[model samples]
Target chain A: MTIADQVTGTPIAGTADTAVRAKTAAPAITLPVVGERELRLDLFRGMALWLIFIDHLPPNLLTWFTIRNYGFSDATEIFIFISGYTAAFVYGRAMLESGFVIATARILRRVWQIYVAHVFLFTIFLAEISYVATRFENPLYTEEMGIMDFLKQPDVTIVQALLLRFRPVNMDVLPLYIVLMLALPLILWLMKWRPDVSLGLSVLLYVVTWQFDLYFSAYPNGFWAFNPLAWQLLFVFGAWCALGGAKRMSRILASPVTMWIAIAYLVASFYVTMTWYVPQLGHFMPKRIEQWMYPIDKTDLDVLRFTHFLALAALTVRFLPRTWPGLRSPWLRPLILCGQHSLEIFCLGVFLAFAGHFILAEVSGGPVMHALISLSGILIMWGMAWLISWYKSEADKSGSKTKNAVSNADMAGGG
Target chain B: MKAKVLLSLILLCGCVAASSARAEDAVPAGPPACEVPAYLLTTESQLPKTAEIIRDNKPLEILVIGSRSTAIPSSEDSSYPARLQAILKEKLPSEPVHVSVEIQSKKTAEEAASGFVKLMEAKKPTLVIWQTGTVDAIRSIDPDEFRSAVTDGVSALQQAGADVVLMNLQYSPRTETMMSVPPYLDNMRVVAQEHEIPLFDRFAIMRQWNDQGQFDLFNPTRGSELAKQVHDCLGRALAQFVIDAAHVGPAQQQN
Candidate 1:
């Protein structure tokens, strides 16, 4: 098999090889594309996703200290870049070690994951709306809830709500993630397993998105809430850096130059976010940005929100410790272990959030009760995560024992 | 842990107190609880000035009556009457004076004066202001009654040894259909010249805003175009009237 055809265990490996090797020269910094395999990047991806969850929650006590409302809460922007970054890291490595076939399959799998996540979150959002509409006391309870009455239709307006809600400005991002994952494997394959070609396309996607507003978009309705297409280039750049492939970039990061730059960025983000961006919190305080941030408006991502998120994310990467603090400590090991199995943690978090909302949310109380409510929410989530991890560990141990027993029986039968 | 909790509690209380204190300062105090003064102001600087120059050396008690919160005060300090009081305080501090105003809605000049009979009796004020006639239009109380009420109210004050300044009332362009008193503002000059009461024509101020682009002297919008014009006009009028009246010397300064 030609270099591209030497497939790995995963089907997308060949294509992953091609994508990782592709390259594009950007003036700011050089990042060598890592072959498709970096678990640390996964940790970042998971962290970004987690931040998004917290960001989505209504601002109250826990979120207050968070730079969330500030311009720097660009946690969402980091998710997009990391999404692309991992694609090149994983898919490119797969392609080089294995083949295009493995790369393609893995790409589809990632895409499917995004679609599932979207559907799940969308349903959760819709369910919350229904709960509020039905349960809340609207004084105008009788006025022809005419159009609003459609909210009563069980799942009737689900499709329309998805389209019309226009939330997550930068529409269809969840779906976009899936589609990009699918297409990326091929894009990687076509790059002839070269870093330049893969990265060049990613940069091109970013440029088109940033300057030209290129996304599958409507006038305003379909503006991409998270312009992954544009942000993908940053991922490609970071991937290059992680692999130690971008020679010029590696030198810069090693030099004192990057340290100062990172420091300056950190200070600037803090200043702008606290002083300038605080007041703008009231702008998003109202629940109105829902209409265009969803569906498929890829073109209309908010420039303000996107740029701020990117700046903050970059600063964090440039400065925050590579490994989480206290992660190796025995007392804190459980939490880091949970992080290792993030999908399980996510599922448990969702379940816990729902249960807490249903059980404790209606109990009306002021700040004291609210503090308790939030406290319970955090504790409940952690509890569920611990339980799930424990169950998984037990099940795996049992499965290993059963497998060993069957193997011994087979050997005895042959004797 | 208890100490920490107590510290937190102290911090929380401090925050609450600070926020509330700031809010209180943010809004300037409104009219006092009782026996408040209403504003007296002129709409235009060019208009003739009227000040109830005290002759017998009694403190001038000025009262302004109005329709609503937004109604024109004689001046910006709520009424030109108050400004008159301020000037009196500055120029004649030892004159044993107290200037007071009361704003009332739905009262005719006679009604306003009659209500103040006890106050007039108590304060024995030497200066009276009759701001009515708009209500006369609203009630369509007889025009003759309006004229007589003005006369009677003024006579009542003067009989009590107080001089009077009448503020003629006008309708906003808003009240064409509701008013039945035949727009008394139009005929105020007749009453003032006939009664020989120094009528501060607030009506003229409205006319200036409508005709000459001179804004409402008491725009009430606080520094809005209307408010600025009223403030300017009333201040100038109060200043000029006081100066002119001073020239007449304290003896001839009567209603």
Candidate 2:
């Protein structure tokens, strides 16, 4: 199997050679295409997923571990960038092999799947909020969740939701993802001819977005929490890197000067973020500096945030090589499993984050309770990932048994 | 075991005495019960326009743009804005200090910000104190959007020739669990810093008060009377904050 197949997390169809190896492999192991896949991507994507889950819940001491506490960017950037990279890596191969028409069809199919997931998540989310609000006599749940419009005018809100204009707090990511995925076919098509110019076009769109203050109007007022126009730059940049940009910059990236520059940028961002928490640090920060740094706009994907994420990625690549043994460690297995099954795990995370928030708000909100809720939420995500992986492997085994008798004979001989 | 208990009691007593002593030091000019920390009351950003107006001995017109928190039910005089006006008038007897409140009830920062140019054109105050973030937080507006709105508002206010002081959300121990507040709070602080203006950290001050047992913020039994006391304390604290940021005290007068 190619690396593309592994990145997409779709195990190859049953063959006699693979069936023999599967039986010989450990009974506990469920991960498909482990050694061939880019473990670094899976590992970091998994870590980002966990961080997103933690950040979604109400703020607690546990939040200090999130990247937002230390830098300008957060898990959202990592998720989007990796998503772009993986999409391009997997589908670019498919496009090359099967031609553009087939690839575009597959992309649309994925977009439809995401759209369905988003609608489902939205429905369940509204139900959860309304149920909690009515059952507990705490109308704040509906209000605080930004579902008040839905509660008041379900008809209009449902249409707006279907149009992807209305979204509750923490529900913004999926809609943004849906839009990005829908645009990917075109992006991939453009990249096929000229990857660098395509990225330049994306950057131009970002600039024009800021210049004209163009954004999609959210329901009741304001704009999208994650502006796709500005954010598409990062996504396209990821795709660019996956195609050939990284290879072109391999020498520059390997240079000591580039590494030090990335390190300096990270340290500077850390210091700036620290000054937000510790006001005394403001004494060292000049007024002009503050003027330049104010409104580090996350919605529009500020340049500082984009650069910060790039710096982080640069450092990550430097340190965590693909051959790093830590990637294959047993401790990181749960995270890897979640990352491998990112879509379902992400949906689960969104649901569990609200549930966690409800428990903390309704029951107790002490430090101990915060710790328990955070740990258990992640444990549940991990458990779901493990179950899905196990089930997929079992299904694969059964399919192999039905399709090929030679594999079954090899499996029986190995057993 | 008896010695250990006696030692612990002595230590506790010493801690109480030390705290009381600190509170006493802070209470000479402020209210006896509302001794805010020096750091909480002070701002690194100075109100230059306000200081200039005070030094010139002109009428100090202060416009308070806020939401529901600016007013009290059935007792307009007990609201923070009213109490602030009273305190400012009492302190600056020579200068005609007028604190007028414009309540933007149930409005987010963006909505309120869009109204600033028109409001400032009419009001024309030397100092504008903006109390926001509660409605935005409750409504779950995007923090980045909220930050940009506040930035635009502060800029508008400054261009209108007013020294702006931003006030963040009120702290309630009960709602603290249900809603997320730090993003709004941090964004406000960033805006205040970026504009080189003082932010009146109402959330931090109130949270400090609750933590110190100065007020039981979680208790519903105290009701409006408790709200009155809290507003009064907030008014007095805000008055002091304005004075310090403007640097209009005896030391500044001598300078």
Candidate 3:
């Protein structure tokens, strides 16, 4: 808005300058606020990323603690949900401050970040796949790669991922997250222009996530991929909880009728989950898209998953502490720091993970060597993060030109 | 034609064993009677009261014993157990039957007896169809031992208030190894005769089909139309027998 000054009468830049200062940097940790926010969002994101690393890492000693055969599902559900909560917390204010234009820019930047991460990860995945393929090529199993496969595949354009209208075989959640973030501008627009409308729309999106599972179940045997539509309700739910929390939970908690309804809703959702008999268990409910009768693909959203997610969201929002007990522990300080800077730490963690797998499991030795390598990897990533932060602070000290780097980005964007 | 004739003879012989002399027309009415081929075990069939009993509208309880082949067909839609249930319902529409054709543990008649007793007690069945000896035939146990175990099983079912019927092993061509059925089937027939229980005589049906060139007995197709033909034949027969054994009468048939 500020840069496009020629089109408007109002001084968009000046208002933005003022709003930007108030919004860019979150409040400082005086007593417990920063600590609490970090735990609420970052801890969950931090832990999920950690599990993901362990899940992918090769045979190693760390597998004992890190690998989960069937662990906390909060992996995909909590990460995206936390994304929603953070989007609501940060972007909701952006919408209020600079209006929808900057909100669009913000959503775009976030999606771009996910896109960049995916491109980088895809390159690494290919490199590893090729390396392994050369060592184990057979009719049943091949560790071979063709250049055409990479060229044809990496060509799945940004447009396809953002629309979630394309599926590249063997990919995971990066595209899904990118596609979901594309909806942020509209979400914020609705939240700003009409809070009730936006809130209702979020609820409806959640219903879509629940209703869309049946559509994808037609494939033979089956597929293990997560449906983005089915999964986004967790984020939308987290967003709602972040934006609209109330002590007025007391109103319903003590009410006998509300308690009974909650109990009944939870039991029914659980039953549906256990049985997998809901039509959405295998495919999406098609009737919803048909006004004149049309087809809407969920891609990953299935009905029971949506309901199960919602039931979990409602229960967590209704019952969980404003600040978890784990947050209060001094022993968890390093975890808290790692959690706060999760994306950066995750990049480092995954880098170390590859090194761990190559050196330990690939070395053809006993597990003791693997354990040593894993510990060394963890410490190395931790040290690398600590050193980077130290160097960045030192650079800031010598530079006399600007306000904090965090604020500089906000100012440069004029938001 | 001779095989069909012989199957019909075996079935008639089975009817003769279970039906009391006066039950030629005085048999009780139930789901068992619905299997009378709609032609043979009719209201006016000249058989014992058990035949009359099978002609009536009483619920049928069928016990199927077989291996994975019988329990779960490549197409579940045509599994023998599922087919038998369909036949009982189609024939004895007035008498909705409960069919329990369990995966009989390869041996241990003592264990198989529970499933049999439970089905009989719940449905108060007038007839049953046993399809074991195929598995026992594969893992060759002594034929006499098989007979005694099966006899004990039949005694347990009769004690549970059931009119027991055993199906003789027919043919198994697909499996690499098979237990020869001549000894097992013959022993089962003797036990059925001694206990006065009906036997389905699937051996006779398969032999007839093979001789007629409808299917080769030992090398029949994996999932052939003949299997379904034999399944329907036995299901229809069992429903009629149950109805006759229930002593259903002509007046009830009209109503």
lDDT of each: 0.44, 0.74, 0.48
In the range B36-101, model 3's lDDT, one tens digit per residue, is: 222223222222333434455445555565544353333445555676676556545566566775
Chain A TM-score, structure 2: 0.87
* Worst 10 contiguous positions by lDDT, candidate 3 chain A: A1-10
lDDT of 2 by residue, A199-305 (tens): 99999999999998888888765578789999998889988887777877778888899899999999999998777655688789887888777767778999999
Q: On residues A295-406, what C-alpha lDDT tens digit does candidate 3 reach at each position? A: 1112344343444444554555456554668667766555545554555566566656655545532453334565576666656655664664565558556765556654
**Tens digit of lDDT per residue, candidate 2, span B154-201?**
999999999999998786544443344667887887788677799998
For residue B255, model 3's alpha carbon misses the true position, in angstroms, by: 61
| Candidate number with the higher TM-score (1 or 3) | 1
lDDT of 1 by residue, A168-277 (tens): 21124455555556566665554445556666776677767657645544222223334456655555554544333445444555556666765675565454444222
TM-score of each candidate structure, all chains considered together: 0.48, 0.78, 0.45
* TM (chain A) per model: 0.66, 0.87, 0.64
Provide the interface RMSD of candidate 2 in angstroms, 1 decimal place: 11.7
Name the better of 1 and 2 by TM-score: 2
Best by DockQ: 2
Q: 1 or 3, which is superior by lDDT?
A: 3
Q: Which residue runs does candidate 1 get wrong by more than 4 Å?
A: A1-50, A69-73, A140-156, A160-173, A190-192, A217-222, A238-248, A277-326, A331-335, A347-361, A384-393, A400-415, B1-255
lDDT score, candidate 1, position A236: 58
Ten-residue region with minimum lDDT total, candidate 1 chain A: A1-10
